[model samples]
Target chain A: MTLALRVEHLRKSYGAVAALDDVSFEVERGEVFALLGPNGAGKTTSIEILEGFIARDAGSVEVLGIDPGDRQHLRGLRDRIGVVLQELAVESFFTVRQVLERNAGFYPHPRDVEEVIDMVGLSEKSDAKVKRLSGGQQRRLDIGLGIVGNPELLFLDEPTTGLDPAARRTTWDLIRHLAAEGTTVLMSSHYMNEIEALAQRVAVLSHGRVAALGATATLGGRDRSEATIRFTLPSGVAASDLPITPWRVEGDTVEVRSDDELRALHALTSWALEGHIAVTGLSVARETLEDIYLALTRGDRAEIDEEPDDTKARTP
Target chain B: MSTDVRPAPQRSRFSDLRLVAHQVKYEQLAFWLNRVGAVFTVGFSVVFLVMLGASAGSQKVQSLGDISLVSYYVPGFIAYGVMAAGFTTLSVTLVVRRETGLLKRLRLSPVPTWVLISSILISTAIITLVQALLLVVIGRYGYHVAFPSSWLALLVAVIVGILGFAAMGVAISAVVPNQESAGPVTSIVFFVLLFLAGLWFPLPPNSGLAKFSNYLPVRHLIIAMDHAFGVPRGATPWAWHDLLVVALWGAGATLVSLRRFRWAPRRV
Candidate 1:
């Protein structure tokens, strides 16, 4: 597959602190790629470098086969890329339709304004002024502006930071629909569930470095983590009665860590049946993306301290 | 999936012009919808015209060929109106837009940075023209101020004043640190310059203060407007010196603004 974006050894320092430290990744065309990290993980810095908003200190970066550092190429590159900034960026006095039409004029081959409005689910509020729209509606308008240009690539920086659950789900559907239509999307978000629901691949950044990068299901060996099995035992059943070799008991509940969840579940169910004891609330779970993310980022505090003071000053 | 999509065409200067036209149209629409700010922008000029005309309409000033005080103040207030729209209003709006991330958002669009800046300047020019026309109408009917003696010179002076002041506004916005400070900084700069321009009252010819005022852009703007309206300052029917001074200030301010302009918020 063709790559939509590629960054090799991207390095950016704000004074002495390295905001993006030798980061490298490639996003395939028509794929949904997520940059997952905490608040100071340099997500914004990395994305901005790719977007041509900020220059990188040292790196080889390409978007749509154009170097972002090439000022002359920026106008052409911008025509093919759509960006939904992290902030609510719209003229408050303009109506929704006006805002869409204005932004649509910036590109050579813009999507129909009405179609973009409908795609973002802002049709009903099309005539309402931007200031009058609810926070969620305004956010939809922001998305509407981003897609109005019919861009081949879209960059969404924390697309659903403050959105309610329902609104966030709608945005997720919108992103999925776009990717399905062959629009490559690069999204940065701290919400792990959002990454799980939409991203085909994810790169977790910690302390300005890619701590882990892979397909969402397999990131940081998540698929290989031990499964956790928990069940509540029937009254008068003691933990010692369980056939499992290693188990912990709390109240009437028993927990067991199992490498093979299917076999462990089968053995426990059979034991319960033989002992005439019921296993209530039985569940088998494994480490989630959030768990893996925490594990990857948890040990980077010392690296932060090792940086020179001038580099540290640029962290924020 | 088909990968036959063509690359975006190289942008021509004509496209940049078209973008500016489009942006100016929407900016005008936005300004119109902001009724309160719009009212204040234009209303301040009207209020000053009425107050000054009512109080000193009949008083004759010798430098203006014995024209009524209302006539003298007409050109002065016109200069004031252009400055308000171009310098004060533009600065405040630009600062607010920058603070709200509107400029940064625009930067992400295919619109060139120059196009964005030019569109705003053009919008302010349009508004200043409207204010000038309205002030003339109010002066003609309400206070009997004469029509401009030379329409062409009046047009040139107004254009020069608008462009110059608009550039100055953009420069001022760069110095302004944040939105909260935008108002106070612009207002203080505006009123101080207005005073130096002799809007409330004309300074005596060849006096120390008036000689100093001759070097200021606002004073030159007001004097040029007076000469264009057939109110000769002395021997000449036009104020070439004043026009040159105003143009130089405009050019200087524009240079400063272009050098210092920032699309994104400044980092501490």
Candidate 2:
């Protein structure tokens, strides 16, 4: 498969602190790749380096087969790439349409300004000055400017940070649509749900290093982590009556760990039937992406109480 | 999945030029929309011209044998107006843009660095010229100040003054820590230079202050403008020495700004 971006052994430092140390990852063409991390986790540094805004002290970075660090290749590479920075960058006085039209002139080939405006759901506010638009609307204008160039690879840094839930969903749809149309996207976000919904693959960073990296479902061995079965015992049923021995009891709720979920579930149902006790509020859950992420980044420091009481998942 | 993908077309120099033109156009639009800033840029010079003309209309300067004090003040205020547009306005705008992350965003765009700088310079030149024209119109109609005897010399001096001050503005912006500091810093430097260069009244010739002013670009600009206005006969319209001084300052400031200007805001 052709790769849209490749970063190997990237190293950057600010004085004595290393912002990125030996960070490496690859994004295949036409895939939505995510960089997930908490604040100061090197997400912005890595994105800025790939955007060609900052020079790395040491690394090999190639975007679409062009070295982003090479100045001579910048114009050609930038023509095919789009960046949505964290800050709102458009002039506050320019109307949405005007801003899009002005940015469109910078590219050799660009989408029509009207089309871009509509694509970002700003058609209704196209004539409104940027200063007059709401915060979310202004962000939509920022996204419009990014895509008006009809770029082959788009970099979105915290694109949905301040967006409301509905707007966030819309942005996710737009990103998926772009990927379906063969435009590769690299996005950084702290929203776990956003990453779970949009990213096919993810790299989690912590303390300036890759804490975990893999397909979304398999990241940090999330898919292999044990499933949890929680049920509220019927009235007059004691924890001793439960068939599962290794269970945590709180009030009337008992949580059972299961290596083989189906077998454990079958055993519990049979036990309940034999004892003539009804199980209520039964919930079977496996480790979610969030669980794996917290485990990987926080290691043993992650609060045990926060984890779904079933089985301890190994931290990557 | 295999699919045919077309290679992006090669960009041409014409596209760069077109982008620069658009940038200039937008810059002008934004400047116009900032009504308070636009007014202050030209208003200070207009206020000085009117006040000086009203108070010193009948007085005559010994250096300018036939020119009245009002006419003598014309070149000084014109110099002041150009400085306001080229230096104070440009520097403050740059500081604000950098602080607000606009410069960083522009840097990430496909537009070349030269294009962005050139567009700012072009827009400043245009705005300064308009201010100078407005001052001229007010001087003629309201105060009866005569038109410049040599338009070519006046044009040359104005162009040189704008280029020099614009470069100085960019240089000053490099030193300003943030937008809040931009106003005070630019004002302090401008007012000090304006006083030394004799904006309100001419400094006595051959005095200590006069000798010190000789090194300043504003002084040379005012001297060039005085000759351009034909106040004293036998004075050459082109003050080559003064023009050279202004040109040198412009070159020096351009170099300094190129080295010091930062696309990102200061971390602190």
Candidate 3:
């Protein structure tokens, strides 16, 4: 697949703090890619560099086959990409249609203003002032402005950060629709479920470094990792009498860790049936994406606690 | 197929002038639809003229060549309206937009930077024009005050004030840290300057208030307007000296804006 974006050795800093260090990633033309990180992990800095909003100290970046750092191509780069910032940037005074139409004027090849309104589900509020709409509706409008330019790639920075469950579901549906229409999306989100639900590939960033990068399901060896076997022991069973070695025992409950879960479960079940030992509450669990994300960024989170608190609430 | 990012050679896509006009249309819509702002700047001026015209308009001050109070107030408040729309309202608007992320969003769009800035400046000029016209009509017909002898001179003063004060507005916005403090900070600074410049009542020439206000751009603008209206009965309409001081201040403010302007919200 042809790549839509490429970055290598990206570095940026503010005074003494390193915002991004040697960050690199590539996004294919029509795929939805995700950047996952805790607060202050360089997600925004990276996105801004890629968008050419700011200059990077050390990096080679190409967005849509053009060097975003080159001033001559800055407008061209912006024309092909759409951005939705964390803030609801729409002015509150103008009606929904007015604001949409105003932004549509900025693009050389803009999508139909009415079509954008309908796609974002704001047709019902077309004449209402922006301030009168609910938070969810405003966010949808923000996304509409992003796509009104008919962008080939879109950037969404925490698109669903402060939304209720229903609103988040609606936003997710909207994003899915855009991706289905062949818009490559690069999104940064703290919501594990959001990443899991939307991204085909994700890069976990920690301390301005790529801690892990792979398929959403298989990152950190999650698919091939050990399975955890848990079950409650019989009341009179002695620990040593078990055929398999137990990892931990608490009261009448027992736990086992196994790399080959099929063999482990077979041996345990056969022995239990022969001896008539009733094992209750038995279940097998594997590593989840959240578990891997936490493990990768645990140190970064501890370090961020020492800084100012605005970056602290990204945990989900 | 994915390697080509340029769209249709972009040169023939659209006109930058049309983009500026479109953005200006929204900017104007935003200014007027926010009724509080429109009333605060435009409506307030109209009300001030009617109230003062009824109370002390016919009385002669004997200080400003014994011109009627209405004559003095008409020019003074015209200057006031210029500062309100170009300086106070524009500065406060910039601060709120900067702190709220609107400015940054505009920066990221495909529109050229010049277009956005030009649109805002144009919208401000339009507001100041409306207020100036309203004040002129009220003084000419409502209070029976003599109109400016050189309408062209009055236009010059108003235009200079708008451009200068608008630059000062952007300059002040760079220093005001956040939205909560924007209104109070700009208002206090604006009202203090207006008071010292004798916007409410004409200051006697060479009085202590006049001397101090002479050092400021505000009084210079009012003086320019007063001369344009032939307030002292046949004085030359172009007070080029006073207009020069106002333009210099605007130039300085433009320098400040260039050096310090920030689009993104402060991290606070």
Candidate 4:
């Protein structure tokens, strides 16, 4: 597959702090690539570099096979690359439809304003002033403006950050539809679950570098051979004389780790049968993307002393 | 994916042109709908015209053979209208956008930055032109202010003045950290210019301050505009010098602003 975007050794700094350091990633064409990071993790910086909004300190970056800062090429690529900024403060004076229509003029083959409006579920609020729309509705309008140009590549930066759960789901569906229509999407979100649902692949960033990256199901070695089984033991069991099986117990519940689920289940059932013990509240679940995300972020945060003031400084 | 030719999107300067025109059109519509803004422009013109009418008598102070105090103030009023359009409209809108985060949102659009800035300039210019026409009509009917002899120079000065002040406003908006500061900063700068440049009242002709006012842009613009009303071009400096200054200021402002502008909120 042709790479839609490629970055090598991208670096940026704000004063003494490194915002992005030695970061590299490739997004395949027509694929949904998610950049997952906490606040101040340089996702915005990376995306801005690709969008040619800010200059990179040192790096070779290419979007659509063109250097982003080359004005002519950048302008040429603009119509094909749509950027949905996190903030949706469009000029409130103009109606939603008017704003979309004005932006549509920049593209050679823009989608119809009406169609984009309907796609974002803002058809009913099309004529309303942008300032008057509810937060979710304004976000929908922002998406409408971004896609009105029928862009081939879309950059969505925390697009659903402040949205309620229902609104966020609606936006997710809209994004899925866009991807299904062959538009490449690069999304950034703090919500790990959202990324698992939306991104085919995710790159986890920490301290100016990629901490982990892979397909969502297998990210951070999640798909490796391991299963965690939890079961409640019957009364008078697990006093350290249970069996030769690999297991640990805390009170009545026992957690067993095994590479073979059938073997573990067989051993546990046989032990219960032999002992006339009942296994209660037995359940099995796989490691989720959230688990990997937490482990990575926790480990990464432990490596750096992030003063709380630094977080406050990043927010307005 | 081979041989997938959908007739690649056309590359055209006209694309930016059309986009700019559309932006200006919508901005103009919004400005017209702003009742407070409309009152400042149109209502201010009416008030200025009525004052000139009431004082059109022996209260006249003649700068040229045929021109009266009414005609002199007519040019000043028109210049004031232009200033308000350029500085107040553009600055207030920018600060509000900054406060509301609208300006940052526009930066993310595919539209070129120049297109966005120029669209605002063009929209404000068009609105000011309408106000100027209203002033002209009121001047002719109510105060009997004649059409100036130097119409071309007056037009050039107004256009250059608009560009210069709009650029300055953009620069001002950039340094202003927020909306509240935006108001006081713009108001102080604007009122100082109006006071020193004699937009409310012309400085004494041939006086040192009046000559010094020649260096101020609005002063020359007003003089040039009055010249459009048949007022002679005094041996003093011509309007073109002020226009050159305005052009330089515009370029300087654009450079400073583009460099200093930030897309995200500042760290407090």
Among these predictions, the greatest lDDT belongs to 3
Q: How far is candidate 3 from the true structure (C-alpha RMSD, Å)?
A: 4.1
Chain B alone vs. reference chain B, TM-score for every model: 0.91, 0.93, 0.95, 0.86
Looking at model 2, residue B229 earns an lDDT score of: 81
What DockQ, on C-alphas, does every prediction get? 0.34, 0.31, 0.41, 0.26
Off by over 4 Å in 3: A232-243, A249-254, A267-281, A302-316, B1-6, B12-14
lDDT per residue, candidate 4, B188-218, as tens digits?
8877877777766557678887777666666
* C-alpha lDDT (0 to 100) for residue B92 of candidate 3: 84
Model 1 reproduces a share of the real contacts of 0.45
Give the better candidate number (2 or 4) by DockQ.
Answer: 2
Give the candidate number with the greatest TM-score.
3
Per residue, candidate 2 scores C-alpha lDDT tens digits across A70-93 of 888888888888989887777888
Q: Per-candidate TM vs. native?
A: 0.89, 0.88, 0.94, 0.84
Once superposed on the true structure, which residue ranges of model 2 sit more than 4 Å away at CA?
Answer: A229-243, A246-255, A262-284, A299-316, B1-4, B63-66, B206-215, B231-234, B266-268
Of the pair 2 and 3, which is ahead by lDDT?
3
Model 1, residue B32: what's the lDDT?
80
Whole-model lDDT per candidate: 0.83, 0.83, 0.86, 0.75
lDDT of 4 by residue, A1-316 (tens): 6888899999987667788899999988888999997767778778888987777889899997788867667767786788888766666767888888877876778998899989999878888887788888888888887788888789999989999999999999999999888888999998887898899999988888888888988887778847888887667764465553546778777777777877778877798888788778987766788878777777554222332111110101
lDDT of 1 at B161: 87
For residue B68, model 3's alpha carbon misses the true position, in angstroms, by: 0.5
Question: What fraction of the reference interface contacts is present in each model, in order?
Answer: 0.45, 0.43, 0.45, 0.36
